[model samples]
Target: MASFRVKGGLKLKGEIIPQGAKNEALQVICAVLLSPEDITIDKIPDIRDVNKLIELLSDMGVTVRKNGPESYTFNAAAIDLDFLETQDFLDKASALRGSVMILGPLLARFGTGKLSKPGGDKIGRRRMDTHFTGFQKLGATFRYDKKKEIYHIDGSDLRGCYMLLDEASVTGTANIIMAAVMAKGKTTIYNAACEPYIQQLCGMLNRMGAKISGVGSNLLQIEGVGYLAGTTHTLLPDMIEIGSFIGLAAMTQSEITIKQVQADKLGIIPEIFRRMGIKLDIIGDDIHVPSQKHYEIETFIDGSILTIADAIWPGFTPDLLSIVLVTATQAKGTVLVHQKMFESRLFFVDKLIDMGAQIILCDPHRATVIGLDRKYPLRGIRMTSPDIRAGVALLIAAMSAEGTSVIDNVEQIDRGYQFIDKRLNALGASIERID
Candidate 1:
């Protein structure tokens, strides 16, 4: 129950090297359980979710060796299946939604996996039907114990089969892919999630001797291999953090350089922000945001108002919508911020409204932000951080507001970000974390 005491209106200036992809790292770390050999992963972010998954692995008796500050080697040869059935394991694993990914590797390696209902951000209704359905199609038996609220999956005779997913769920596709890698026959997953994270996982699994084809595409074909050997993989820069930084710099009107950004992989994020009338100078692999005195949203070609909504891959990421919505507060024109993936994500706009923002929450999924154009500076107030993305948005709001703001629930922010306070402090942001 910690809070951040932030002094607003400081123009932070400096360079920030984005952390490793948190979402990608989660999937890749779980893929280590697919192989019994030495699997080395580099550029791992030291965040709460990653650490929680690693702790879950350690508790399950996996051999975890820290090679350096941002590297680790995992060997799943001695994973204890008996530990997975205990209440102690459920208590720890249920706290993190990433723990659900372990089902695939565990079922693939040990022929059985057990899990309690996983917990994560309450942004919307995140269904597990896609994951369970994919597993059932792979010749596995899935049983639910409603009394204990546990899912029991037994893949004793798991045989690969062709199936199409109803939705392209990132984590669900990853879980199925991990399980299919060691199955007895060929497995084809149509309508799979082909994000950079899933592609990286497939690439790493391929390097480890799994036969996977059509990478970076929704139609994935995997030929089951008897076993997978160990391999080393390095994660790309966190694109979410990069976008967050872009919004942060614009909100505070600061000049900041983001170093080592994988610019090519960040599809449409920079462009989406540009539509909001913010300028971005891409110097080689870095993105530089200059101090802006004014920014205005652009209308559509037909003279209609601009609408920015989230969708699947090759579309604007849902994670960055919160930041984008917050950045639109000081803009000169109105824009519709549509969050289609999650239902309750736009509820955080009420907090922004309290800070003197001109926002109209149309419904659960859409909000129209009328730009204040800095006519009146926002007055900071006490607020609570709801989820990871919303928490960062509030932090950005607090940093650009006129007065001091106290944001409670720092734990929600820490779950996804890696030493955010310490890192932002280096860039001249006055955020004091109090316990």
Candidate 2:
């Protein structure tokens, strides 16, 4: 277990570039299996989950080559179908939630896909019904082994059909799109997830010979093609990480510039921070957050308490709710953070309460933060990270708190952010990684 010894109350300065989008990286990397041709991806973040997926592909006989520090060329022409039955595959696939995505491409191209029950952040019950349900709609046979906790799907003669999704799940939509691209007929998907990452995947698929329309809308149409060719794709900057940096700047009263943020794709993230009283300027593609001693939360036009909730894209992202909750601690006035997607994400508030933030755990789904206005600064304390988002939130809290704080299980943070400590240290924050 790795821990971070963070010295609190240091104001960070200079610029930080957000890494490649982790969510998009997971989806696109899995898409490489859709074609046997060479697929080169640039801006691949060097994080644990993405690296694990790459390794999984390599173990399955996909030839992978490093083109640069953050570039890779993958050729999946010689995949070993039998490897899916191995215990090694079972163990590895069971550990990553993203591994479930490989199912669509494998079933589409090779007619069969096998996977163990996937694991990821212990936030709540992340159901796979959407994925399997979409597959079944596309003429795939689905089976689950309760005893082994494994999933099996067969798409020997996949025929596309129109379907309305139960939820606009990003991964679910991506999986179904990948499968339908090579099906026998046209597939129309209503209520599809239209996030930027999903659009990127759809665009890349189109560039690779897929007949997809409605790239940035809730409705998607796909015409089955005989084959797909490989193409080079570059991932967008992680919006979640950019949001985190914005919160970090405000919490510590730092002047930090986040560069090449792809501002248009951020979708209300900047406005969400502005509502929290953080002053941020969008200069070209960079977000410049100036130093602030005090920022006040905004109320609704009707003068009601401001509530920040997560919904599907175009709404605020649920991934940054933890950062919002932590950032609201030192601001003026109050805000309610409603984490609609995950039930257990708000449980980390107790740790922030321990650090002197006035937060009411309204329930499993909501938290109300009464800002201290920086009058009562948080005091550092030893704590353990429960998940990636909460871990980074706690690190932000500790950075703005008085004295030093020790955060255990920093591997959670490492899974998302690349060289976080070193990057923040360059901007004048004091953080030491202890093994």
Candidate 3:
């Protein structure tokens, strides 16, 4: 496994061109199954999850070719659906939760899909009940063999129906929408996840001649078409990475500019950072964070203690909350971070506490951070990465600390971030990849 050894107390300064959004790229690549012609996607991140999906597609007889570093051409016209039942296919499909997205398109186009249980960060109990229930509502039958962990789906023609998801799951909504795009009638999905990734999926589907409305809202209307054509599309910038860079610049007291941020897609990310007294200037599509001595946490409206919490769409992303919590440790105030989405996500704060940060882990889901405000820079320490977001959070914490630190289990970081070490190096971070 690869590890990162970072020398701390370095002020990172330079411009970083963010890579494509991993979430969007996953869904977009899976959409290729809906067409018989070649589909070219530009700016796709070369991350582990994407590569796994590419391997899965290739195993199913889909022709996948990498035309460039971040570009791919997919031709799924000759895919063999029978491979979905193999053990090798199941092993690859279980690597990431995003693998379940292929189910919708495969079932829609070929009338059958077999997949194993999907695996991802063990944050909480991620249920596929919503996905199966939605598919059943749209004229599909589901059969599960628990012993084998294989799910079999079959249907003659998908018929549109009104679907109210149990929860606004990001991948579940994408799956349902992909199935609905080629159904027999109109599918109205209420309480849909309308995050930027979903918005981009909807836009791409529209470009491919699928009629979809309510692109950026909780309600989506999709008119089923007989067939979808292939089209070239460029992905949006990674907003989560942008938020991570913002936290890195703030904690390290660095002046950095993030290029091609797609400010229109950052719903309330900037405002959330502003609450922590982090100033950001948007130069066109670029986000610039100026160097500062320290940051102050803003309190609530009645001068009471403030708390930052995450919710569904239109609210703060739970993925970025870890970075926010770590960033608050070096700020000038106290704030309670409530990560309601995942129970085990807040457990990483113990590592920060080991590094001399004053953190009160209330429970499995909450933590109270008392900022040092430059009184004490976090001292270097050895830590293990728990997951993708927490791994990046630890990297930021290590970069802002004094002396040296070692981070083990970097595979978790590589699963999501594309060429993270190279990107951070461009920003002048003193980090080296050691195997």
Candidate 4:
């Protein structure tokens, strides 16, 4: 059990480089299993989730080599299929939701796959039906072992087919694509997620001999190939971390530059922060946010209070809603933080309220925040991080408060952000990790 002791009221300065995307790394690493050849990946974020997946791969007999601090070479040429049926593999698979992605690659290369009920943050009901349904659509026979809580999928006779997904599930879309790429014929997926990560995965698959089109659209087409070749891939910057940095600068009145953001891919994130009256400069690929004594939240064109809500890609991301909520606490006006995707994410607002933030927890999905406008500084207090996003939000609040605050169960934070305390400390913020 680790904890973070954050000293508040310090203005951070200097530049901080964002790590490679955690979400993308998880998918790309699992995709390595689709080929018998070696695949080299760069810009891999050093975080808990990714390391856990890599450990799982190593345990399954994949040859994982460290090319550099942020690079690796994975050769799945001699994977042990028998390991999938063991209790150790099941327990490891159940530790993170990203482990579910390995099923698609395993089924694609070996004709069979097994998955335990995936585990992740307790934010909402994340159903795996979409992933299973997509597999079944591609001619894979799927079944659930009720007593063991395992899903079994066989892809020995898989053939490409049409699938209209119920929603734009990101992981589900990636999983199905990995499975469909090696099927017998053409496969078309409608209502597919078009996030940058998905596009990158599609591009990588194409480079590795898979035929996939419609890179940035809701409809994707794939022509099955016999086997994929090993190829190198570099992950995109972590957009979620960029959003968190933006909110951190605003809440703490800091002048921080976030480096290597690749601005165009950020979509609506910068604008969402600007709507909260946070001034940001897009200097090349870096985001420079200057110190602010006061900032105001904007209203709608019809004079209604602004509302920040999450949606699929091209819309606000649900991962940063907690950051936006905590950032709005010090802004001039009020904004409604609506977390439409997750039910339990907003429950952490109670900790912010105890820290002197003015937030009304309307329900599981929405909260109305009345900005304190810097009239009264938040008082630091102790808290437990419930999930990854909420954990980061609590850290932001603690950093902007009036005294030292301790955040326990910080493993939740480590799972996503890499060396968060050290990185922020380099910019002059005081965050100490306590074991």
Name the lDDT of candidate 4: 0.94
lDDT of each: 0.93, 0.96, 0.91, 0.94
Ranking of models by lDDT: 2, 4, 1, 3
lDDT (Cα, 0-100) at 244 in candidate 3: 96
Q: Against the hidden true structure, what lDDT does model 3 obtain?
A: 0.91
Candidate 2 structure quality by residue, lDDT tens digits, 8-84: 99999999999999999999999999998999999999999999999999999999999999999999999999999
Alpha-carbon RMSD of each model? 0.8, 0.5, 1.0, 0.7
lDDT of 1 by residue, 259-314 (tens): 99989989899999999999999899999999998889999999898999988898
Could you estimate the TM-score for every candidate? 0.99, 0.99, 0.98, 0.99
Q: Say which prediction, candidate 2 or candidate 3, comes out ahead on TM-score.
A: 2
TM-score of 1: 0.99
Model 2 vs truth, CA RMSD: 0.5
Better of 1 and 2 by TM-score: 2
Between candidates 3 and 4, the one scoring higher on lDDT is: 4
Worst 10-residue lDDT window, candidate 3:
79-88
Candidate 1 lDDT (Cα, 0 to 1)? 0.93
